[model samples]
Target: MSEAPALPPVRRVGQRSTLAYGFGAAAYGVKDFGFSTFLLLFYNQVLGLPAAQVGFAIMCALILDAFIDPLIGFLSDNTRSRWGRRHPWMYAAALPIAAGWLLLWNPPELSQDAMLVWVFATSVLVRTAISAYEVPSQALTPELSADYDERTRLTAYRYLFGWAGGMVTLFVTYTWLMAGPDGQPDQLNRANYAGFALFGAAAMLLAIFTSAIGTHGEIKRLPRPEIVTKPLGTHFRELWATIRNRAFLILMLAGLCYYSAQGISFALATYLYVHVWQFDTAAFGTLALSLFLGVSGAFVIAPRVANRVGKPVAAMVFMFSAAALLATPYALRLAGLFPAPGDRVMLPLLLTLFAFNTGCGVSATMLGASMMADVVEDSEAKTGRRSEGVFFSGAFFIQKCCSGLGIFAASLILHFAGFPKGAKPGTVGVEAIDRLTLYFILAYLALGWAAALIYRFFPFGRDEHAARVAALAKGEAG
Candidate 1:
């Protein structure tokens, strides 16, 4: 092959690009938090669907989403368009994502089975819409900033925006949308949920548009990645190559474990707070505030932490801390050292734990994502092809599978624990609550610890990334 044309000089990403790119995370927050924090609660607890059924429906959607993820990633990577690979999909997805989310929350009166069908249909639609935007958006991150620490910093800005959006949603939900209907459980009020769904969907539209258009100016300057063609054989070749890449596989597996474990915790947090600890709406809002503070602070400080200790060590430290802190409440409660359910200090203590764990968790999350970006460099070094979209899609695919299974398992556990649906706060029996706590702690510890160990084996760090970039610059790799 003729020598490749001289590559354009790569400029470091600036403040305007970082802010515009980072603003996209607000969509993630609104969509992710709404689905995670409230979907099961709304479908099963409030709307009288079985927990298992709701979980099953959503699980199916995630599975469906996982299948399409890689295809979209591949398409985006090879796409040649004026609007660029990522933004066309990003812009096209905005209105549909909002519509899908809104439809999910507005199901008409129906039998349990009918509701299950509606749930499955809408859930699939919304998740697909998300992947359409999110897979492309995430793929853009590695392209946005070439510096390792700069990527971390840009991601930190992303997390700050995302967590800010999620926090605001929680505050609004608890303060306004959580009003208990007369003769109804606080979570069961349909009107309240409509309002929450509307806000989330609306915010998603605005944020996606802002990011898609905001970043439009840079797409031409972004690498015009060499395209690959020739159908199935080429795909299989690339797939085999991806599988053989050790760093990519490790990052994929560890992310799967961590996110799956997190799914279980998020799915059940409401039950723990309301039935086990007997917290009211205001207290629930306080928990949201704690999470906001923790994640925001982590986003602010995690890049510096990684710079000092390196990304792998920083990842292990933060992830392990999160796991340990998350296990504390259950350990203390089981040991009979925790405050009684109605104790004045109980909420304060729980909020403190939440803040610490959330901070560590978000910190770990930031470093891990940056680590994956480094994998893109390693991948290019080895394969001489840039496939950020496929790599990121694989990450999302793992996350979707793990998260789906986790949600399904959580519902099964709830049923086995005999958790009451739509029950008043503080009404669940101590035995059931104990069992729920045990399940949570077991999952969190086993998965989180294993993931931490796996991350320790990750081969690429700042030095490795820098070396790879240097080779690419000298045309030793491309």
Candidate 2:
């Protein structure tokens, strides 16, 4: 093969490019909101499937879809095209993802077995389509800039927009689309979900295309990998070698635990609010605002914290703090120390603490993503290959497990707690609610703390990353 062309040195990405990159995450956010918040309820409460069946279908779908991420990542890494390595896959994914999302929400009337099949199939389609875009899109972070702090800043914007998109969708769903007739808590109403499906599909399509077009200008400036002709087995071996770094493995493990906790928290959010806390539609809208505030705060908090304490330490602190904050209200309520569900101060107090918890949690997530980007250069310095796609695909794989393992775990909690189906808020028995709260608190704390402690084992920091980048640059110049 001919010698590969040299690329320009990595510099600070422009504001416009950064914003466009961040905006792309809105698609993933929208998808996440739908899956975590409504999918279980929609199937179990509205469509009349059993909760175990619904949760199992979702878990199966996510697990099945996760296997596709690495393949998409590998293909994108070696793709040669006029539009570049990432854009073709990104553009190809838009329509299919939107179509699959629409289908997922609009399943036809069928038997219980057939309905389960529909859920599994549509869930897999949507998740796979999302991977086709998200893996390549996330890989761009390393290609766009090499500075440690800049990567954290870029990741902050990504998380900010991602969370904002979900929160905005949540606000709209509660305030208008899912509002019960005559102020009734009719989240179980079927018609409301139809509106949600349409809105989510349109938003996802727009975000994906906008991001692809917006970042198209960066193709010329980004590095292009040499197209290698090798046996398929040989390619897999190289991929394994590139992704087997100690830092990458630790980050992946940490993400597995962290995202699982997130999955469980998000999956059970509706049940907790509607049944345990007895929040009304108006309160749900307010909750959205609070979450949005927290994620926005994270955009500022993560970068500053990373700059001061280094990404690994900052991530550990925030993760441990977030876990404690998140579980406090549940623990206090169970112990009869916090405000009762109907007290005037309950909503305001809970929302305040939730906002703080979200800020810290999201800060930790942003720092972790930045840390993954740093691993790209560290791997490249040792292996002579840039495997952004492989590494980010590993990250996405862990995220999918969050949906699978986490949601499945949530279903078990519900089953073991004996949570009744189709029960209205404020009507569930005290024993069931107590069991639910206790199980959630225990599981959440265990997973969150485990993820945070795993970060302490990661091998390098800012200085090591800088040294790796310098070494790679020297190799290129030679």
Candidate 3:
């Protein structure tokens, strides 16, 4: 074999660099909130589409994303560019992704079929655009810093900004846009979404570009090891090899289950908060603020938690804690211990539960992502190949696919409960609300714990990764 190309040494990535790159996840946050929080509600309640159809449409889009992501990863891994493989794709994705997102909320009035088509088409474009940026951008992480602990710290910063971005969007949508004209908080106000979409699209563009431009200078400093050129058939062989990695497979499966639960919970939360709990607009805003606080706090706490207990353990603990906490309200309600709607204790109790759950839930996500970063080192050592783009793409792919399944599960539950579209909050039957709540609780508990359990199979850890890095260093010198 030909001599391997010289690669740049791993350096201590500065705080400024992490800050800039970290904010890019803000774009992902914006996209994620749009899909998980509003897409189903907007279509089913506002436009009068069936909940199942709306959920299925988004799922179709996610399926497309699942395939497209890996393709982008493969392409970016093999790409040659002066501005660098990751940056160029990141910059190129900004406007298209933003415009695609904005257009999703602006679908013209049409037949139900036409509307479904619109949702699917727009969702595909938006997610594909996200993949172009996110896959490569995340792939850039291993290049930026090789230190295991520093990777956790960097992801912490990223998740913080990610939470901030989504919180801003939620606050604006709930407290301002959806609050409606005087005395009527109309979340069903279709016009309000136009404003939300405009702002979200603009923010997405800004976040993507800012990170891309900020990190442009560091491209030359990153290692650019020449990939071994192989026949086209070898592509399938490598992909199969990647899939067979036990650690990666475990993470992917767990993430699919966990994020699916999250997707369903997020979709159903507004319905429960406004209808079952009978919270008004201002209270909804407060709930959003509470969730934001929890997520923010968790971001600060995650790196420390990881340092103390190790990443895998920290991820499981946080993940399980979040799930158990999310099940609290429903469990209480089912057992007759929950405060009645409009009781003084109800809102405070709800807020407290939501905050803790959100904090732990987000921390779980950050820890898992950081762990995946470590997996890159392990995978390279075993396979004797660098494949950050391919690996990170799997993470994003699992997230999107599972998010689709979550929405689909929610739709099934809602349909079974006989919940009607366009039904005002507090107007649905007590039976429907009760059924929804119980299903929500069970889904969260089961899926979340299962994810945690599955994650226990990951074999790599501090000593394993350290050994891998040392071996890699020796090989490079040879």
TM-score of each predicted structure versus truth: 0.95, 0.97, 0.96
What tens-digit string does per-residue lDDT give for candidate 3 at 1-478?
Answer: 2232343244568777888999998998888888888888899998889999988888888767767999999888788777766888998899899889888999998999999999999989988998999999988777777777888887888888888888888877778878866543587879888888998999999899889988887787766667677998998798878767888888898898899899888788778877778877678778878988898889789889888988888889988899999898888988899998879989998899999999998888888888888887777776776778888999999887877777788899899888888887667988888898888888889999998887677787877777677778878512
Instruction: Give the range where candidate 2 is weakest over 10 consecutive residues by summed lDDT.
Output: 1-10
Which ranges in model 2 have alpha carbons more than 4 Å from their true place?
A: 1-8, 476-478
lDDT of 1 by residue, 1-478 (tens): 2222232233467678778888888997887777777788888888888999899998888767767888888888877777767888898889889999999999989888899999999988887888888889988788876688877887788878888888888777776677554422276677887888889898888888888888887776666766646778888688678657898888887888788888888788777777777767667677778989898789877999999999998888888888999999888998899998779888888889989999998898888888877787788788887778888888877766666677787898898887888877667788888888888898888888888887888886888788778788798885
- List model 2 lDDT by residue over 21-84, tens digit each: 9999999999999988888888987888888888988888866655688888888899988877
Q: What 10-residue stretch in candidate 3 is worst by lDDT? A: 1-10
**lDDT, model 1, position 225:** 64
- Report model 1's TM-score to 2 decimal places: 0.95
Each model's lDDT comes to 0.81, 0.88, 0.84
lDDT of 1: 0.81
Model 3 off-target regions past 4 Å? 1-11, 182-184, 476-478
Clashing pairs in 2: none
Which has the better lDDT: candidate 2, or candidate 3? 2
